[model samples]
Target: MTTLTYKADHHWRFSPILWGALVVAAVAVYLIFQDGVHLMVRWWQRDEYSHGYLIPLIALYLIWQRSDVLSRIRFDGSWVGPAIITLGLVVGLVGELATIYTVVQYAFLIVLYGAALSLVGPTAFRIIAIPMLILFFMIPLPGFLYNNLSSQLQLISSEIGVAVIRLFGISVYLEGNVIDLGGYRLQVVEACSGLRYLFPLMTLGFIVAYFYRAPLWKRLVIFVSTAPITVLMNSFRIGVIGVTVEYFGEEAAEGFLHDFEGWVVFMACFGVLFVEMWLLLRITGDKRPLSEVFAIDSPQKAQENEDTSARHLPTPFLSSVALLIVAVFGAASLAERQEIIPEREEFVTLPKELGGWRGRVEIMEQIYLDTLKLTDYRIINYTTDTEFVNFYSAYYDSQRKGASIHSPKTCLPGDGWRFNEIETHAVDGVTMGGKPLIVNRVLMTKGDRRQLVYYWFQGRSRIITNEYAAKWFIFWDALFNNRTDGALVRLVTPIREGADAAVADERLQEFTKELSKVLPEYIPG
Candidate 1:
């Protein structure tokens, strides 16, 4: 018998490269602290992003699992790493000036990846690439992209959920996202919009894919399948809630059970993912047991004594210097760029009468105002002898951060009003500060009641109909003019019991003509 003995070598030595790397990391972290805080706070508050907190830990654990392989690779420092770091800093500077936290967060990850690449060359980077790529799941999607995705997901989930409810022999009426179920109405708000499941599940699927010792195609399928699985499962959850409400009353869909149901649904999503993997394995004639699928055992633990040589620490001096310069520049830019809160009269005294239409001012609840985060707003019920319309204008002095305008497409569904159609309508021969004015013409209905709404985003010197276009202008204006002032101006009129929508349209169009004249005074076009 041969006896093999291995020495456990443990040593701590601070090299110049290590110190340089630490200094660079410390400076980078310090510069991105504000963005980091905002992201963590959002993770705590937003359920969709709650999984963000665990992504980094998981990534680190993954790297540790492959430590043996990583440890053996010698660091071949590259100048490209410094170049990437410079690009990341430039991105952070742009985000800081624009007040877009998402950009900063993304830049933070880029800088982190660049730092790793700087210390270890391309070979080592490829070895630990998955963990670094996993960092992307931590950054929240930009607001514009999130809104569009949420809208589409909400609609898809709502449609499928309603179909499920119908299959259960429940009498259901679906208009947009509102489900009318005789006794209880279900509005598939943002929470029920599938994003609550998609984000977390996508993160989970990525992790599972990383661990799954399978063919590349199998792993890819497992990861990409999370989206549709999330959507389908969320829709099923909604359907289950509908059935519960039908039998057990609305209380079944609220309170503790509701929260529990969400957990159960998420767990079900995990089960579905596993089932998918199993089926794929069967299709490929791979007979590996499910238990044997995960590659969780650390390679370093298995082969520790095989190698004990100390490799020289390759300090990324160029990258470190570049990062330091960028951090300093970013901090200076942020400190110097003042938030331009342009002076404008408040919206309190909008007017009692406009274009011969009498108006009555109404106040929004404090809770709504808090959520809106607008600098000022005005809500008024304008009426004439034969027509009544609601005029609302919410103003944000600075929209680069939170408290931006909410699209009616997102808000109206929550109020049990289902939008039937929403399209951009160019209001010919009308102008705001002598520019073409376009508006989104929306037709919404709640049961038998119908309403016609016309709304547009009023940014400085622009009357935009598209919400995304408004976001673009906000970014451009924020960068060029140091201003992100904008307002969502909406006019809603009822399509009276027997009256045609055309009548309501005429009333809103006439009111808008008068509105365009005075909006510049308060909104500061």
Candidate 2:
């Protein structure tokens, strides 16, 4: 009997033409995605997304880890690559027209995927797909979505934290997101919403799951468990703070101790994730040590006698590169197109007295002015013989970059106000541009006080009540009319003790009627 042994031999080689094409493609991609990339980098400066800086490096490392398998795969590009690149370019154009960088960021990722697929083709692309997907973790959520999520997490964490505080036999009253500990009220502000931990931990979990050699279901569980783990750990930290503050002092919840506690809790969350992975392994009857099971395997080196050869550049890859070059030119043209900021009267010129109401203009705090980033704003308290209404209007000369009109639905909750009721309501006798003036009517409560609010987004010859509708119109007008300027007009009044809600509603309607008449000069709709 004769036994024959066969050894596999392969080598990685790229022709000079392919290298030149790659350089051109890279420059084109950077030019086309520079705006979105810059936006993402800016967002990374924030606490919740600081992890963005490390994601790309990790993706590169992950791809490097697969170099052994990649070395053997032939670089035959696919037609699908150009199709995907075209699709990404189309999406990017829409994003640019709308001045929404978040959409553009997603399109950048799609184009990157297409470029990779074009370079390596389907057979090898599959090997590095997860690493490619890991790049997505670098992008931040859109402002509107981030605000909504932060508000929801704040409420959830507050409720759980309050429950934890009760476990220590402390008397605590929960109102919206506030934790009233009789003397010291702990407001569960956006900072304590656990997002700072959640985002980073989720990214870590995803990376861990990718490396974990386990059943698919088990890997998913490991990845998904990060969210709950973060929430629970953060809530527990808040509870400990509450208990410490009750026994020690308010200082327990501030300064060094507060920051240190956060660090500890985050570390504990990581520990918990590891323990979960161990438990999962044990449950599956795997007795190997945890370190041995979960590890980064080094890429195997190519044999010394491996054959090295160079092939011509694929047509599909050339097509993808050509598409990117055209996209870069298109993007440059769009960048030159300036938004139309219509001339409007300053908020200072708004009437101090309207009809029967006497108005007192109030200055916003420096902190709020910094946060809002509005071109102009006015806050007036208008009072009549028996009622008072608070009038607020925030104008943005342009909402193209990152600055935008904050929706009350997100802002109110962060201020410890809970929405009791919200709906669209049309004023009986008020008209805007020959149409009935419609507004978002909101009844919000904070502790024992309740307030009725009426607000609408006025811009580009449109009065919009829905926040989403406002965004859509901003996109539409930005594309067609070269305008993304808008203002949020809000009228609010308290429902006094022993007063009917209808009374407050009537006060807002009356104030809105007067306010709408003069709104055009300021909002320029």
Give the number of the best model, judged by TM-score.
2
Candidate 1 displacement at residue 430 in angstroms: 3.9
| Residue 166, model 1: Cα distance from true site in angstroms | 1.9
- Residue 370's lDDT in candidate 1: 59
Off-target runs (Cα >4 Å) in candidate 1 are 1-20, 253-259, 302-310, 313-319, 361-373, 409-429, 434-436, 442-451, 494-505
Model 2 TM-score relative to the real fold: 0.94
lDDT of candidate 2 over 487-506, digit per residue (tens)? 99888899987788888887
How many steric clashes does model 2 contain? 0
Candidate number achieving the greatest lDDT relative to the actual structure: 2
TM-score of candidate 1 relative to the true fold: 0.87
Candidate 1: deviation at residue 194, Å? 2.4
Which residue pairs does candidate 2 place in steric collision? none
Q: Residue by residue across 77-184, what tens digits does model 1's lDDT show? A: 667777787788778778777776777787777777777777767776787888879879877776657766776787788889888988879989887777788888
- Candidate 2 lDDT at 368 equals 66
Off by over 4 Å in 2: 1-7, 261-264
